[model samples]
Target: MLDLERRLRGSKQRLLFIALASVCILIVLLNIGVLSDAPGIKSTIIKVPLRGDRPYDTIPFPTSDGSDFEGSYQPEDAHPIAGLMKEADEKWRKYEESRSKTFRETVAKYREKHGRHPPPGFKEWYKFARERNVHNIDDFEQIMDDLRPFWAIDPKVIRKMAAKLQENPDDGIAGIHIRDNKVVNLTNPSWRSETLAGLISRFVKYLPDMDIAVNRLDQSRVVVPFEDLQELLATEQGSRKMKSDARDGFTKNMGHFLNFEEPTGDWDNETNPEWFPYPGRQYMDIAKLACPPESPARNENLTVEDADALYKHQLGGLVTNFNLSTDLCTVGPAIQDQHGFLYSASSMIASKRLVPVFSECKVNVNNDILFPANMYILKDPRYVYDKTYDYEWEDKADTLIWRGVTSGGVQVEDNWQRMHRQRLVMLTNSTLMSDQEVKILTESFEEKGKYENFSHFEPSVFAKKHFDVGFTDAWGCIPGDCPFYKDIWTFKEAVTLSEQFKDKFLVDVDGHSFSGRWRAFLFSKSLGIKATIFREWHDSRLFAWRHFIPLDNRYDDLYSIMTYLIGTGFKTNPADNYANNNNVYVRKHDFEGKMIAMQGRNWAQRVLRDEDIEIYMLRLLLEYGRIIDDNRDEIGYSGDGSELDDFDKKHPMPESPPHLNWNTI
Candidate 1:
């Protein structure tokens, strides 16, 4: 039994040992796997594989909120940060409220002071405040400070006042008092006299019944009678002198004023009913008395037949001197048969003769014949100065000077009237001639006749024809002789007139078109037909060599003519190369294209050129073009370069040919 018990104990001990060894081996394997795979595993031993497929070292632990530790972890909110954020929000809200309150108060205050709502800038309100009393920013600021605590006054009012005061310190004005009585007398003499007279007159005329008083000695007393005071004023030498000299040297000339006397009959008589009579009537009476006696009637001694003969002889002399033809006799019936004058009293004076005889009749006729001649006298010298004269006489004498002989025993003061009459006859004779006669006269005039008074004659007779040939030329009929009348002719009309004489006149010479003096004369006989054509078409020829030829060749001439035209206010379009070259042309991409081209060419040619003027003109063209383009749409025109482009394309750019120098272009 002991042996069997020993065997059982031994078997049990062995089984226990085997079990402990197996456990030890498992622990060792786990330790080796965990410790060997992971680096720096010091404190705790973990299993080789964690939950699911994650490695022990890679899997993160759960945080307190049951989220991933890396993502959920956050630092605690510090007291300083939270406190600062709250403080900022509170400050911002308070600031906004304060600003809004300030703005509202300012607006309200401005409205109250100005009697109307303030403008957005409070400009008027500030001006008013400155004008009242607020003089400087300090004053304004002080007022604002005083009113800041009050709800009634606006802070903005103070601010605006402060700003205005800062801007203008002496803007206010106070009513001034004159303490010294002598100060009034010491005032500007003319102003004081005028003011005093005006005051007295106004009281006399407007407030006749009202008492007039003055604090001369600072005592209030009933006013004296205005009439009595006026009498005293009239008697006072100083007052009378002032009144007499009121017109300066004007009233001193007694030739202009009239004297009047009290009425002899019952003053209120129905027939006369005169207080004194109109000053104008008194003037007429004075004028009648002042006028020199008329000469004794020399024509009265002669019979009507003798008078007719004398008149005919005088007319024949005038006609002969003026070179008037027999055709003028055809209108003889329309003319007057007066003993002295050429035209009848009722005759419609043609413009050709009106200028001359009007002056003659004005000076010659007495009151009996003056009735008809009075219609010819222009009331104002300005009318004669402006209407009757051309631009040539603008700088000449104010009154026209004339020199000539007179007939009909008419004693002339100045020979101006006679000379004026002669001029009229000459002008009339010139206009009334036939085409052939005109040609002959014009030739004769050019050849033998020296220019008498026609200082404004142009090289071409077109100007003469334009001024003369009244009924035949439509341009002559334009009111005021406006230059714009020529613009009324259509391009077609101009083209027709051009074509009519193109073969005869517009002949090409030396590869260039030119209308000589003779051809131009014939064309001008009608109505400036040749001038119109040349001005429109061949006008470009004036600047032809500018584009294709070197500027140096004719630069001086080109520059002079261009400057002249520009100075004279000639209209030039950039597209119209015929009227003007591309000198003033402007382009969008190249604003100073022409100037640049000019400068470049000048530099290439080694010519000293006016860069300033070239650049200035370029800038002017660019600016003008921009202004025109901007307003074109409103002006019922397309802003696109259509018109300019079309014209430009038709006139091709001159190409540089062969080995020619580019400096010319």
Candidate 2:
């Protein structure tokens, strides 16, 4: 029996040991899991590879092989005189260069002797001539002589060149025809009226007839009307009287205002103190307080409506009245006065709710006045007014004497005083409350009454909608201060929320103002959403359609009337399609359809036009010049190729067809 009992005890002990081991294992596993998931435990480090490459080198200039100036050569069969002149021009240039040294030396000596300055009266003229490299007086005279003959060249050639350059200047070589005293070699694959105008203005001095044929130097032989050249020049010169006619039309369209006035009595008699006892006297003082001398007695005879009207009129007058003593430039004093006026108006309005004396007086507190003033006072505690000014007495002695007479001053009693008296009477009339009831009713009401939540209360029904969307209504009476100011945020939120809700909400762009910043934020927050922003005041239709089309990703459908041009189909030459200005092809369609087609067509025309080409070339030159001007420090090259180096570094060589290698084909 003793042996069996001992065995049973051993078995029980083994079971207890097993249970202890299991608890230990579970605790260890729990700790390991917790520690592994801890935020502080970092897993591994990462190293990203960096890829570096060298910057690009400047491209070299292209070599010329008559191919560069291919289209510029006059055909052997056409214009025999032009071909002869070209040969003669080459010979003349060589001869002129050989003889130029002596002339240059003589001119330098004369300039040095003259002290390198123009003779006094010629300063302006000298400055103007020097800009065009006319350093010597003789060169200036030559330029003036060139301008004197208007019809020296065929106006046709001048117009054609202008039109061509207006279209695309890259198509041909630009040169001055010395014999004809005209500009030539305008080649544009595209042509536009504005481009033509620019060309005409550039070379208006040489009036060429409008029938010259404009040809592309390449394989494409594109030809266009010279009439475009003539009309463009005429329009540019304003010789067509468009400006004068426009002014006349504007004057005729203007609506005139009629002069009228109401009859009035003599000011002195009407304002006489005897006839009009009050005259300009206001019921409220300039400080917006009740007038001291008239207040208590005036309240007796004035009706509530009359008193309200008088107070409003006086408050408005005080606001509008300019104090000459204060410098108008000082906003500090003006803001102070504004705050004082607002406080007084609020106090009077609050008082009116009690007495009904100022019932009709409506002082509109708008959003701008509320938020800005609240923010100002919050930022600077000193903005609050605590003290009043004493303007009546000269000294303490005078004030004491004045107070002595007013000690028993008549007090203005009203119905508001009676209401307060009745509140106590009602409480007394109720059955006596136990301690628990008093705690529940009185203490609870004091802690959680309507007034306790005044801060969160929407000032009015209309204000609730605006406040929720982020706008204040404290200065509602002021222009640009009402809930309308929130139209921008409202519109943006509507559009954004609509997308998120999937057609549950829609913003009327026409109905509300849209702020760009808010719209940007909304669009950024939503993953697959876009909103159209429309300008409120200027060209609303254009702005709306443009914004909407872009948002819808319809790039091809949108068109700007300002940039519209005629299509390329009407041109006789197929190469004209490539001309910058000449390529606009106007098709028969609705305005909207025409606008869309005009976009790409105009771009093609501009490339083909000659005058457009010249302007574009000049623009490229200007851009290169600006770059050189801005980055003068980085300009560097090796050795004595430095004469033009310094000059070119300071003023980059103009980008031209020769320098640009523009035509790879």
Best by lDDT: 2
Cα lDDT of model 1 by residue, 9-63, tens digit: 9999999999999999988977876657566554255344544332113223322
Q: How many residue pairs collide in each prediction?
A: 3, 72
RMSD of each: 43.1, 36.0
Instruction: Give candidate 2 misplaced runs (Cα > 4 Å).
Output: 1-471, 474-476, 479-514, 518-522, 525-665
Candidate 1 local accuracy as lDDT?
0.21
Give lDDT tens digits, candidate 2, residues 390-420. Answer: 1111110100000000000111122111121
**lDDT of residue 530 for candidate 2:** 18
TM-scores of the candidates in the order shown: 0.14, 0.13
What is the TM-score (0 to 1) of candidate 2?
A: 0.13
